[model samples]
Target: MTTTSAFPAANRPVGQVIVRASHVELYRDGQEVLRDVDLEVAKGEILGIVGPNGGGKTSLLRLILGLDRPSSGEIELFGEPVSRFREWHRVGYIPQHAVAFDPNFPATVRETVLLGRVAPRGVFHWFRPEDFAVARSATELCGLSGLEGRRVGALSGGEKQRVFIAKAIASRPDLLVMDEPTAGVDPESERRFYDLLGRLKDELGLTVIFVSHDLGVVSARVDRVACLNRTLVYEGPPRALHDEALLRTLYGGGTVTIAHSEEEPHTHGH
Candidate 1:
């Protein structure tokens, strides 16, 4: 493990427990973004959070990252309160949108991925040799080796997505939260990305929480699904969520269609 000598006092959790959010309520400017949200993810589980556009999926993720505080309730990571998790290295995140960087910026894929190790400004700007090894491993896992020297802007939508994924996995975080990771990718890329996720979960024992608007893909990929609409509507195995009536209740009514010969897939905000 790469030593973060800078934060020597940082508290590192022991054992396999990863993330737990309890009775979380998030309010923005007096309007509630999330209400009474309770969630938990153990190591090696790929959990999916799905809902309509304003359903607070992103808000839930932010709360887990400690980027935002819940108006009420508590969040715990590795048995410690989120407020006490000084080692931000244990968590990795991929936001819904691509990073806002100059298209012509001269940054190689490896260099960009190494940036993830840059701690708070006061810490050392240097990345240790182990950091490079981690980054290289992530790149190879994402099949981005040959493109390491390529400029960030020169990649396709799927390629750029892989770059971001590589960056997230570079540090070998115990938990990864990805929001709308396949938004712009083609079907083939999307399928491949999920396969990659499954492999990571199995090999690395990573607890993944991924949110997407596509129910078909999410249902096929994740071990379990949670329907969220400012609050958790359901939490159970994907097989139980195949009900058309349940889909209508969760998505505010839509023409339920069975994609890939599976039971009806939910659609919302159409």
Candidate 2:
């Protein structure tokens, strides 16, 4: 684990709990989507949730984001029960397929990012100088400085993703949540995207929670991982992915390729 994983597993500094789920269970349409899920994320930690398709990874995220209610159990955001949590300005969410805009959409990068502020400030309210300042900063941070006036529809997939991220961060949320943000991005773009996330974490001290199936990147970038498979299979440091039993339980003997650091990826059936 030490030879492969970059983050040290022991003596990790403890921070405030930003998200917590206890005994969470959800049954939708008579199908059990999640069961007995207990998860917690500390402030400023990058937590990755990984699972097979239809394994309740998104379901859990939806619950955490308060999009869907859990049938039984509790979820809290920033120590407040999710249902009672109303400080939405402190949270930013990028849903799955959030960047699936039509190629001909008329909104420019600046316009789209400005939308993030509309929710925090009333839609009826007019934009202020501070709003433009924040939007510009977010655009620049996302590397979309030169394309502020360019139509988002004309941008490439990776550029579109950055635009969406810029929009998400424009609100200056303390917690940034994303669902498969790298879905349509190319490999190079994915690398840059994670790098941007690292910058956001450092510069803004944001606590990030994202759902992804890209194990290679997840293993390398995240501080902790919660492997979901209709239940919580494993929760610990990225180094825990090396456990064959844990991988088998989470991936169910699927074709698993784990790349450790700059070292080559190793394939194992588990």
Candidate 3:
């Protein structure tokens, strides 16, 4: 029986935050997208960011990953200012719509995953035997063991996601950040993806933060949920998603109707 206490974040001191955003605000083309956002993620916790479309979920991720800067505040990774943080090998990121890239790109699953090693091993370093070993292990962990030789272009959306995850872990990162990771995958595949992530977290002591539009995935898999709609509307336990009062606050007077079942996760509309 695995518990949250088994993870480093649960056992560590109260103040060991791995990621932090303090009073972060953003503006693109003179339009404010995010405002006064302050969040902290402890090591080993799987934190989910959720919100309505155009809620700045992806925008927040960019700041956290250092892909974009905040207009008015600070963002930190591994306790260092994201601007000055240079230990990038310790981070693994899968951007939003990762599978939307060109399908004609010619690269096998193994070869693509091996590319992750380049960032960690240095661009000038030749591929070592251990790199292959690492890639193989990552494939197995992501359930891509048999598809190693297959062209990534030929794989389905779900399969491509698995290959990308394999590549992300190939670098053996301490923090894994994903933006809308399961966007186009089916329900069963989404469940399996989160399951794989749970296992990876336990085995690797990884800290996970991701943007998820699916409320069910956040409720079922994440340690905490941050609700954002241009700003932080809520940040607490996943169970709060079911609170009608909270839903009203988050959705801004729109009627929210939740429809759920055993197989597929239907959305709660606002």
Any runs in candidate 1 off by more than 4 Å, and if so which? 1-16, 99-102, 120-122, 261-270
Question: In model 2, where do residues sit more than 4 Å from their true spots?
Answer: 1-13, 261-270
Identify the leading candidate in terms of TM-score.
3
**Which model is ahead, 1 or 2, in terms of lDDT?**
2
Name the lDDT value of residue 156 in candidate 1: 79
lDDT tens digits, residues 1-270, model 2? 112133223434287999999999999999999988888888889998987888898999899889999999999999999999998888899989866868888999999999888877775789999999999999999999899999999898899999988998999898999998888877778888989999999999999999998777788889988888898887778878777666766778765668875333223334
Q: For candidate 1, lDDT tens digit of each residue in 82-162?
A: 998887877888988864445787888988887766652227556777778888888899888899889988787788888
Candidate 2, backbone clash total = 1
When sorted by TM-score, best at the front, the candidate numbers are 3, 2, 1
User: Model 3, poorest ten-residue lDDT window?
Assistant: 1-10
TM-score of each: 0.87, 0.91, 0.92
What lDDT is reached at residue 64 by model 2?
88
Reference-based lDDT, residue 216, model 1: 76
Q: How many pairs of residues collide in each model?
A: 0, 1, 0
Q: Against the unseen true structure, what C-alpha lDDT does each candidate score? A: 0.76, 0.84, 0.84
Q: Which stretches of candidate 3 lie over 4 Å from their true place?
A: 1-15, 259-262
Encode model 3's per-residue lDDT on 1-270: one tens digit a residue. Answer: 211122212222245699989999999999999988878888889889988889999999989888898999999888899999999998999988788767998999989999889898897789889998998999999999789889998998888998998899999998999999989888788878889999999999888999987886577788888888888887767877787766666666677655455375756657
| lDDT (C-alpha) at residue 269 in model 2 | 36
